[model samples]
Target chain A: MLAKRIIPCLDIKDGRTVKGINFVDLKDAGDPVELAKAYAERGADELVFLDITATHEKRKTLLELVEKVAKVLTIPFTVGGGINSCEDVAQILKAGADKIAINSSAVRCPELITELANRFGSQCVVLAVDACETQEGWEVYLNGGRIPTGIKLFDWLKEAERRGAGEILFTSMNHDGTKNGFANEALAEISEMLNIPLIASGGAGNMHHFADVFTKGKADAALAASVFHYKEIEIPELKNYLKSEDIPVRL
Target chain B: MEKQNIVIIDYEAGNVQSVKYALERLGVNAEISNCEKTIRQADKVIFPGVGEAAWAMKKLKETGLDQLIPQLKQPVLGICLGMQLMCAHSEEGNTKGLGLFPVNTLKFPAEDKVPHMGWNQIRQLKGKLFEGIETESYAYFVHSYYVPLNEYATAETHYIKSFSASLQKDNFYACQFHPEKSGDIGQAILNNFIKL
Candidate 1:
């Protein structure tokens, strides 16, 4: 059986690593490449470098950053943010990114997912969904979770999958900065609804939350920023905890 | 002393740089090459790729490598999609491959995740590729379609189901994972291949 992954997400802004609470009040972590090497050495299964500023930049700079990270990091690295076209996908993949995550672009043009998947294979393309729980129930939001589409999370997830997204990185906007725990109910719904792997992001307080996401939420992996950036939960320690819990994690 | 000339075939696919870097890190004399004479003259060849199987195969066909690969005399190594393309046929694009190995690749069952992405354990080990690695040690994987286990299978992995993790047939050796990204175990596997 394939083992579940433990990933640390690093948000890059102007080539520097940054972490925020609920995607605001950004705090400087360190150089993106340096932090990536540290996480890989400390036993991170994979590292995700999100160029949060890519959407705002005049020209795409994530490719340059990916080239830098690829130089030092040996483990698989995924790059996301501001990927708009098939050429962007080709450029990043050529720069040694193991995978590329498409968020806003995917929502804006659903065909981009199929175009990428058809051209590069589905495994290279990932759909990043920022979802929030509302009175009408969980809904999908786009453009860094700033714009609410009012589309039901379940419907959007299914649509993304149908469009050839290999995996879905579901981030809960409600619990993003709270670090209380994952939106277990929402994750469970999606996990049960779709057969594809679900990467639970947003709120992860401690190692226990990681365990909960896997056991209770049925997430294939737990992607966190603040928890790992602040050193609140060491990757090796978390893996050990998950091992004791009978979850198959690569040592 | 004859230096082992290893050339990684390049056609703008993913994972080539890491493979080149890994070979360089191992102090192995390797380069990325697209020239026919260079590939034909190399002592050993490493074909590493991570992208659409159909498109990559098409690129190979366009370069006339699709024909050149099958007749090569030296030992050849293919990683990930490279391995899948060695099979007789691949369901990835209904692609007809190099036919180096008498096997067919198929997509993962729809009941499970389309892409069997993540690290999985290797079992039913065979050949020198797994020299020091113990049974069930993990290797990184990122593919949806897999070449089914057959007589050429060197190692097998179980994701949604048991599939070929590595395959070896005469001078051709292939793996479904990226050794350049698999850490120690992966390096060990690559080292064994280099020694081959």
Candidate 2:
């Protein structure tokens, strides 16, 4: 069976992991390599290192960080944030990243998806949609949930699939830090609507939330940050609960 | 210190980075090269792949590497899609393979998880890659299809039923799972490959 993936995202700033990762045995939890290794050992199916620091910094630093993490990790890792060109994808891939997630660049240049899929294959390219509820419906927000693209969530996902993105990492900006639960309704709707795998992101407060995302949301995977960073939820405990829930998870 | 001169065939497939990074981490010098001359002369060859089997094979053929690879004499390791392409034929895109192994590449039976993407255990280990890892230790996998267990089969794993987890034919060793992502067991496997 296709085991549901559990991913812990690490947001990188200035070449270091920010937002405090409180995994036991580490004094400072902000080191990207250390945090990544801990997550991998604890049964994270994959890891996403998103460069949140946007400046004149070259993608090299991120690649270097990826190399360091890949050294200790024995699982696929996806790198995102400010990936705008084929060269960026190539360099990241060369640095040991298994996949690349695109947001603003993909939305700005829809053809960029096709170009990447053509050059590097669709499975290597992931489309990330940051969304927030609106009067009309869920609106797509880019640039780390700051700018609204005025595109409907479902519509954008359909288009992303059409553009050849292998997977969709849909994040609910409204539920991002709420710790309430995932936006299940949105995720289920998109998962049913698209054939590509959907990775549910945002608002996971506990193990039950992860279970809810897979069972109710029908998400192929659930991604969280704060809950994992604060050590409020342990990945092994969550996986054990999910396993009892009949969700096939890697031990 | 002299580099090991590792060449990862750029058949335009995927997952080259993990292999390169894994090798470099093990202190075995590695570089990605697709040219026939460079690949043939390299100390070792690592063929890493991700993507459709047929399309990947097509790209290799277009680059004329489809013919050159079977002729190499050095140790060559294939990962994921690279392993699939070494089979006689693939059900994926209904394409022909390098015939390096006598097995057939096939899709998992209908309604049996389209992409078998996660950790699963292996049985009947009989290769350099499984040097120190205990039996049934899980390895990360991410493919919808697999190679049927046969004479060349070195290890087997079951998702729905038994299937080849690893295959070895002379100088060629292929793994359906991604050793680059399988944690310590994976690192041990890669280390074994490096020492080979």
lDDT of 1 by residue, A1-251 (tens): 77889999999888888987777888999888888989988888889888888854523566778877877677887889888999887888878787899998888899999899787777777899998888899888987889998788888889988888888999999989888999888888898888778899988998888889998998988899888888999999999999999999998
Using DockQ as the measure, which candidate wins?
1
Model 1, residue B29: displacement in angstroms? 5.3
Task: Give the 10-residue window scoring lowest on summed lDDT in candidate 2 chain A.
Answer: A20-29
lDDT score for residue B169 of model 1 = 85
Misplaced by over 4 Å in model 2 are: A20-29, A56-58, B1-7, B10-12, B34-44, B52-64, B73-75, B91-94, B106-116, B121-128, B131-136, B148-151, B156-163, B192-196
lDDT of 1 by residue, B73-148 (tens): 8889999999999999998779988899988999888777657878888888888888888998889998878887
Against the unseen true structure, what C-alpha lDDT does each candidate score?
A: 0.86, 0.83
Instruction: List DockQ for all candidates.
Output: 0.67, 0.43
State the lDDT at B61 in candidate 2: 87
Candidate number achieving the greatest lDDT relative to the actual structure: 1
TM-score of every prediction relative to native: 0.95, 0.86
